[model samples]
Target: MKIEIWSDIMCPFCYIGKHNFEQALEKLPFKNEIEVEWKSFQLDPTLDAAQPQNTIEYFKEKKGFPADQASQMIGQVAQMGKGAGIDFNFEKALIINTFTAHKLLHLAKKYGKANEMEEALFKAHFIDGKNVGDIEELVSLAGNLNMDKEETRQTLTSDQFDYEISQDIQEAKNNGISSVPFFVLNGKYAVSGAQPAEVFADALQQTYKETVSPFKDLSKEGGASCDTDGCSA
Candidate 1:
């Protein structure tokens, strides 16, 4: 079974969703058979990467939320992160453009390290408060994954993988997805938002049954049998 997840690295719920989804996958008997692909989605595609702003301030200024409401919302998200085993430090988190970060992910995908790359990016931004928009920071993260440091730097500096990033974003729009942390299972089943582990587990099991499991023979009586000999009915 294949699962494609469309998410933005800056989105708090995307990290939470990733953790919940992985937790569900860990318990599945056929977990090894599952293929997960992380797709790119930008919540703020036009944000200036050169001038990153505080996450709470960005929410208040851009989204028109009051100061107290913004803090409350961020606090709620932090609580949600804790529930998913993530320590989200919004105070240190910055709102920066993720276009370059997404390109790095595409490069990592070529090396079969996209999942690892996504996890590292999430931790870098939400936990460690690293500037994901910075090429050097991204290269360092890639190096930690054993990816070639120079190749990663070149890829981030140039337009390499930009096409793949755009394609992923366009595909999300084509699928009517305007939100982050959206999951598509077997190109059919979709679970939106940061749902609980049970929801993901149920979706995974259902998709596996429908797509990978053998068909059931519902015939009560033996209707026909054919082997290397004559058929019987």
Candidate 2:
């Protein structure tokens, strides 16, 4: 079975959704048979990378939320992060454009390290509070994954993989997905938002069963059949 996840690295729920989805996969017997592909989505594509802003302030000023409401919303997200085993330091997190980071992810996908790249990006932004938009920081993260540092720098600096990011975003729009952490299983099942592990697990199992066994045997006894022999009943 194949699972394609469309998410924005800056989205808090996307991180939590990733954790819950992985937990769901662990509970499945055919976990090894599952193929997961990470797709890119940018919550704030027009965000200025040059001028990084405080997450709370961005929410208040850009999103039009009151100061106290912004703080409350961020606090709620932090609590949700804790529930998913993530220690989010929103105070240190900067609201920067994730376009370059998504480009790096496409490069990592070429090396079969997309999953690892996604996890590292999430950790950098949410936990360690690193500037994922910076070339140096992205190259460092790629190096940690054993990807070629110079190639990573070049990829980030140039317009490489920009088309891939655009395609992913266009595909999401085509699929009627405007939210992050959206999951598509076997190109048939679509699960949205930061759903619980049980929801993901059930979706996975149901998709797996249907993909592997699409037919139901309703007959009490075998009908006439032909194999190597001419015919048999």
Candidate 3:
């Protein structure tokens, strides 16, 4: 079975969802056979990198939520984040455009360092309070992954991986994605948000079994599930 996740680098829920999915995959009998693809989705494509604002002010201003509500949401997410081994620095989290970071991921993917860079970016912004949108910080993060730092820096400044990133975002929109942490199980079964490990495990187990083509059940009326081998819906 193949699972594709469309998510933003800065989304707290995406990190949490990833944690849950990993935990779920760990328990599967066919875990080694499953292919996991991490696709990109940017929350703020046009954000100003030069004027990064604190994430708290961002939620309040963008959503019109009161400070107390925003703080409560942050607290809940932070506490959940601890289970995933990520410490979300809500107090210091900054909001910046993730366009460049998304571009960098495509570059990293080419070198088989996408997951490493993804975790590094998450830790940089949420745990270390690093400015993820800053080119310097991005280069430093890529260096930590043992990637060619100078090449990464040049890749960021040039229009190198923009096409792949653009295609990712466009595909997400075309697939009816409206939020981060959208899990496309076999390109059919989608579980949104930061679902728990047991829930994900159950879905994976179900998906693994349903991969067997259902030509035998020709009279079945219900539409093929997202997990079906040749799902048409």
Best by lDDT: 1
Which scores greater on lDDT, model 1 or model 3? 1
The TM-score obtained by model 1 is 0.94
Ranking by lDDT: 1, 2, 3
Off by over 4 Å in 2: 216-233
| lDDT computed for candidate 3 | 0.84
> Which residue window of length 10 is worst by lDDT in model 2?
214-223
lDDT of 1 by residue, 10-51 (tens): 999999999999999999999999999999999989899888
Model 3 CA deviation exceeding 4 Å by range: 212-233
After superposition on all C-alphas, the RMSD of every candidate to the true structure, in Å, is 1.9, 1.9, 6.7
Model 3, range 132-186, lDDT digits (tens) per residue? 8899999988887888999999999999978888888899899888898998889
TM-score of each: 0.94, 0.94, 0.88
Q: Residue 230: error of model 3 in Å?
A: 30
Residue 233, model 2: lDDT of: 71
The superposed Cα distance between candidate 2 and the true structure at residue 95, in angstroms, equals 0.7
Alpha-carbon RMSD, candidate 2: 1.9
| Candidate 1, superposed: residue stretches over 4 Å from native | 214-233
Clashing pairs in 2: none
Between candidates 2 and 3, the TM-score winner: 2
